[model samples]
Target: MTDASSSLSSLIWADWPAPDHVKACVSTRIGGFSPAPYDSFNMGDHVGDSPANVVKNRARFLHLCRLKRVGQWLTQVHGTQVVEAKDDGKVREGDAVYSHEANLPCVVMTADCLPVLFTDEQGSVVAAAHAGWRGLASGVLEKTVATMGVAPSSVLAWMGPAIGRHQFEVGGEVRREFVEHHPATDQAFQPDYQSRGKYYADLYELARIRLGLIGVHQVFGGGFCTWKDERFYSFRREGTTGRMASMIWIKK
Candidate 1:
């Protein structure tokens, strides 16, 4: 890990309040080794990017900061499953990962889905979650917060790039899932007058409401709309697009 500041251009660092020991970043779609639809900095290997290119890009991503440990990458299922971070060099099957250990980054990959990074006021632990619409409706953020082994009130959350509400049209069923789980989320969805039985969904609002339900409320970082922003990879906007990596870890 040498001179990371120069590499900052390829990533969007989490803008949140946590101890200086916590390190987090979301890799953008600019500045990497992949080509075509996964051009340049595509951090997701599962999205049809060349395996070798993914390896090179990940190495570059890790060098963005001096974390000597491997990121706990996951085979995200878009569900509420949470995995404890382990640095065995194995990718696990879960939508979220958390760790109390320093240097061991908890990582999640996303395209249009919301990537969330979490930490406590004391920076005792950190976590990351891949929250697509399905995972959000199923309480993935709550699970990540609970798994961090800290008081919910002290948990701070930062949402990474995601599809904005205006570009995220949802059907009646999708809206029903969230509103049914948390009545407060109804306001997060606005009826699309142009399309009957359709509504514009806000992923950021829904996540904030869910975290609030569990007493975790120091939320931050939600102005990025991946679909419209070429800096990020959006699955909804481009069917064969790449994915971005959002990671968080204690850096003692």
Candidate 2:
């Protein structure tokens, strides 16, 4: 059990050159109603956190963040599915979210996996995606930009905290899969010196290369290491852990 009150001041705000009406932020594991394992700040309701605690945490989150409406939360499955955001209180099943409506935030929750927030230069669109290695290899980011309904060149994406390169060791199969999809992914991976068939993959670099290939070159954020930094959650570091949330919306 820990202090129940928390503030958004410690949150990770997306630093980008997006239009004024566009707002984006990423949550860190800081303070909340949860106890122990889930600790104080856990945004993922599907992670065995108490429903009541989740409700209190999310409600307090909105109040503190001053969001007039609720964010669209999805049942992320590490897939490339992108869905238009809706705040109707129904849990949407997808790994990515997009929205054009004001105050309706597109949210994605993740632990270790990458969470990406997107918006257009004109602030007419916003989207978020949960990109793990599998999601990356399967084109979640590509589909996210496509679902935003904006030209890839106009999309400005910000990658939030994730498992960083140094700690994200992957098997050769993962490397080969990404390289097979795009040769540029090769540059994002470095062979593990101690392991014969493993590599330390740079998710940020991979994402940037993937986004660049689609004409979305102004990618930002992402030097964060969830496993190394105790401020964020990491499923790889802790088998039973909470998830941080990445969100974006157009302000009216």
**How many residue pairs collide in each prediction?**
0, 0
How well does model 2 score by local distance difference test? 0.87
Model 2: per-residue lDDT, tens digit, 1-252? 334355566578898898988888877777678886887678888889998987877776666667978879998888988998887888889999898899988889888888889988899989999999999999999999998888998989999999999999999999999998799889999999898999999999999999999999989999899999998999999999888888888888
Candidate 1's C-alpha runs over 4 A off are 1-6
TM-score of each: 0.96, 0.96
| Local accuracy by lDDT, each model | 0.89, 0.87
lDDT of 1 at 100: 90
